[model samples]
Target: MARTGRRPGLGGTRERILAAARSDFGKAGYEGTTIRGIAAQAKVDPALVMHYFESKDGVFRAAMQFPVDPAEFIPRLLAPGLDGLGERLVRFFVETWDSPAGSPFLGLIRSVVGNEDAAAQLREFVTREVLGRLARALELDQPQLRAALVASQLVGLAMLRYVVRVEPVASASTDELAAWLGPTLQRYLTDPRVTKVNRRSRRRR
Candidate 1:
């Protein structure tokens, strides 16, 4: 009789799942991809997928080769209660990209430049995991706008410093970048001026 349980010696099952997951995520994006779909593509049991990755986010992180788990990292960044968060955020961002672990992130950014699917996936990840979470943490009005503003700053900085390799930004030390960007981030997160601007813009409409 044939065996009815999990296949023994599943040597490449994990790798297969990861490959399938990457494909699915690239095509369907974070919100559209599902564990069952990934398992189907991988030719593995859903149970096996869960056993290996535990959850969809786990699979995403593994497949993407994320350097740090945002779920944990975001909370830690928030632990200091909003004081100097901008500097801390900038410091962390520069340090992470400077390290070997940032290769995957750099690859994703490069892909986003030319690939719509890659761009969508990145937008979703940033909206849901990064911007959305930060907005929620702030517990203030116009969360979406505030988050977008903050993202704009960081994204431009990243493009200039890493992709374009432009002037002083590219050569600047992490400390300098943090010092320059931190206050801006802090303002976006906590300043009443941001809300005032939004209100004024709305009044014009």
Candidate 2:
């Protein structure tokens, strides 16, 4: 997988870097993952990572394999504050995936079922870039689990509507879906009752 002999086109080397970067980022999160580490994972020189991605941020962008940058967009989404973050998140998720721009994600998401590497990359990106960030922003207890719960909501919605194409749920209006889904997401992100219950449950065990 190392590009040794003559310089190969961007076709192979680039794909390799993306795959490696996704794996490391998925496992390590952003802060823990490094360019050198990704290069090593990809079986290529560090120079190649820099060459292909320019920096850690660039590598992360490519690894996410999504059209929108959740790191950038998430903060903006929460700029109005976390009061309606669940609604905001659902809107963003619905709008993006339903739009033409989100077309690629359908294929990318489908790949996750059978493609472990792709799935890892996606799982990391959503957890770190989207759900992880959301959890941290809430500043609540068990941010990791809270973020994961939120991610499950969005992912499940995507699978049901876009992938499975289930009736009623699949054809529901975004507003209707958001109204129905947003409250649960809101509770997951900010409800202290659930948090306290979960914490106590952990203690009992």
Please tell me which predicted candidate would have the highest TM-score against the true structure. 1
Worst 10 residues of 2 by lDDT: 1-10
Model 2 earns a TM-score of: 0.73
Q: Candidate 1 on 1-205: residue-level lDDT in tens?
A: 0111224358878889989998999888888999999999999899999997788987877776555677778888989898998888898888878877666767777777888876876787778888888889989888888889888998899889988999899999999999899999989888877887534444443
How many pairs of residues collide in model 2?
Answer: 0
Cand. 1 TM to true fold: 0.85
Q: What is the lDDT of residue 151 in candidate 2?
A: 81
lDDT of 2: 0.78
The collision pairs in model 1 are none
Q: lDDT for every model? A: 0.82, 0.78
What candidate 1 gets wrong by more than 4 Å, as runs, is 1-11, 198-205
Error of 2 at 122 (Å): 2.8
- For all candidates, the clash counts are 0, 0
